[model samples]
Target: MNTMVWKVDKYVDNLENNPQVVDAANFLRKNEVVALPTETVYGLGGNAESDEAVAKIYVAKGRPGDNPLIIHIAEREQLKQFAAEVPALAETLMDAFWPGPLTIIFKRKEGVLSEKATAGLATVAVRMPDHPVALALLKSCGLPIAAPSANSSGKPSPTKAEHVLDDLNGKIAGVLDGGVTGVGVESTVVDCTEMIPVILRPGGVTKEQLEAVVGEVREDAALTDEAAQPKAPGMKYRHYAPNAPLFMVSGTAGFLQRLVEEKRSEGLRVGLLTTEENVSGYDADLVLACGRRGELETVAAALYDTLRRFNQENVDIIFSEIFPNTGVGHAIMNRLQKAAGNKLISE
Candidate 1:
């Protein structure tokens, strides 16, 4: 199928006055897929209640059946329609961070959401997106929308609509051009189904922020082969990868410089994603500095875009410096390590 692309200037602005959202809504109601931007990442969306529409998302992205999808809603009140019970804590967290980058996993409302939407799991991940275009689309459709990052599975998630066209061009129904995604990463996925909240995937919402709201929040242990059966999105899989091999730079700046030197000495074509402070001393064919230390939000916005840049440049490998594991940095590192494929911790 030929994927139609609609370029909406200032997406939120256009959404306020444009009638195209109504057409998009009608298309979704008929079980079609639409690529829309979010604060975190562009999403390939479908009617969450339609098994056929949800199945199309899996087929479009080649996502695994076991990896669940997140349902996007227009408002907090809509949460009750899909979730069997929204725990008081979950409600509090939602009130604190909804219309932003936080996903809460709650017991499914059974028939309200399709089994395909939740990967047949009893718990469903849901969030009210902060992006106006996304919310407008949902409100127009008046149904829960099941969506995953709008990129082919295992590739870096697209933060821009053009990236969606590059990866999912002919595979989807249409693309809503909403410019660049603000957060440029996925949502922080917290499973409230458990007695104590567990972070299934880290993104724009940090563990610290969640804990600030609910006292204590925990991250799942590092993924294992058996653990790849994701109870929520991005939990258990080789996701957010670029075409080129990616490596994480651990230890001090001097140590990272030596490591890059060694790789370059081996005559390898390397791309570096490090802080601006570290880039001055590194010798690489391509170097993309996210930002200076403590400026993780900048890094988050450029993360996927940098990966796509390296992939386009045909680099053999990418070496990225690790960020301090706090705030958005945690989510950035989560995506970087997954892209790197293996962990290299320095003592």
Candidate 2:
């Protein structure tokens, strides 16, 4: 497909249906893939009902067949068509946070959605995106779209339209550019099947936020269980990796700095992933300030792009300050651990 991108000026609410949206919607109706912005990240989308259409998304991103896709709907009423049962917590959570970055896993009715969308699982992950362009396109398409992050599998997920174009150009039919997404990460995926709900993947929605709404939500063991088949899109992959090997630097500041210096002295071009508080403190060949030290959201938003930038700078190795393993920090560390391929250095 000859990929084309159309930029929407803003994600304003209640705007007239424009020509670009019509064109993109037409492409989707034809069982073609298009990249559209959500509140979280750009998603490469196809008609969820068509097995053949959903299969193309896997080919476009080189994504594994077993990794399921999230079904996006423009309205809540559509869930009745596929959802066999909606848990009370799911209803409460959806009432509070639908049309945002939270994906609720529903036990699906057989033959409602493409098997490829759910990976033959009885449950289907669904989210209603909170972006004007995405909402408008979903409404215009009049179909539930199955989508995953618009980038190569195991690479950094695209947060901007340009990022989508960079990774998915010519592979998709078109891109509906809606500028930078608000939440830089993907949706927090919650499994509603169990008595105690579990988070399959953490992203824009924190565990604290989910527990506040539903009470006693827990992180799934599936996230860390390598032996188990992945229940979510990013669970079983070496995702968000840059070209160079990355390491998570643990222990004191002095120890990390000394280690980086030692590597640089060996004729290696070292890179430092620091924070705003210590941006001027690093002495590596290249240093990138991710975000303010205490601001987990800022760091989460910039994490992937920074890793991608390291490649552009041609750094041989990267060492990052250890992030707090709480709130959005957990999601950041999750991606970092995978990106670094679990190579963590501690004093």
Candidate 3:
């Protein structure tokens, strides 16, 4: 099928008042897929209550049916229509961080939301996006939108409209351009349906931030080799990867340097993504200096763009430094490891 790409101007200041957004929302109401920008990332959106619209999202991205999508709403009031029961803890957390980068899972109301949107699961992940374009689209449509990152399954999530066009250009109906996403990562997903809050995915909102709201939040168990099914989006798959082979560098700086040298000495064109300080003394064909060692937020923001750049350069192999395990770093490293696919531990 030939995809239709709409190049809407970036909605920067007043999204709620944008006429282009109203048109995008109307398009979604008609059971069509629209790529809309969000604070976390761009999402391929469809009406959550419409099975036909939700199915279009799955087909557009080639996403697996078992991997559920996140639903975006304009306000907290919309939650009542979808959730069967909203816990007290969820309410407290919502008061503190609603209209932001946090998604809460709750028991779904039978007839209110389409089961296809949740991949036949009884639970639904929902959030109120902070981006002006997202909120504007939701408000104008007057319905909850089920969406996932605007890219093909197992590929890098799109932070800019161009990335969406690259992956979904001919696959979707239209794209409402908002400038680059500020958070530049997916939303933090917490399962409030459980007795103790379980974090299904770490993203724009950190574990520390969730802990402060819910008092005690635990990370979901790692996917077992035997049971590799993903409970949420971006889990249980080799996602956010570029075309070239990627490696996550671990251990000392010397070890990374040696690995790069070894790969280069083998006559392979290597690409290195590391801090500005680590860029020196590397003989790699392409080197992308991200930022300071501890400043992982920068790396998180630049990850996909850097990978896309390497792919454009036609590098044989890509070596990315492992980010420190904290805040957004955890999520960044998670994606890096998955992109690497096979692990190669250097002695």
Best by lDDT: 2
lDDT of 3 by residue, 202-314 (tens): 78888888887678888777532315445665576788887878888777777877888898899998898887777785668898886567677877777777777787899
What is the TM-score (0 to 1) of candidate 3?
Answer: 0.93
Judging by TM-score against the true structure, name the best candidate.
2
Using alpha carbons, what is the TM-score of model 1?
0.93
**Which structure is stronger by lDDT: 2 or 3?**
2
Tens digits of per-residue lDDT for model 2, 193-241: 8888889888889999888887898777766665667556558778888
With a 3 Å backbone cut-off (N, CA, C), the pairs that clash in candidate 3 are 3-170
lDDT of 3 at 290: 66
Please list the C-alpha lDDT of all candidates, in the order they appear.
Answer: 0.83, 0.88, 0.82
TM-scores of all predicted structures: 0.93, 0.96, 0.93
Candidate 1 lDDT, tens digit per residue, 1-347? Answer: 98887776553565744676777777899999999989999999999989999999999999888778899999778877878998988888887998899888898777888898887888888888888888888888888999999999999899898999999989999998878889889998888887789887888988888888889887776532434455554565687888888878677767776777778889888788876776787778888877566678988998888889898888887777888777888888778778877655472
Clashes of each: 1, 0, 1
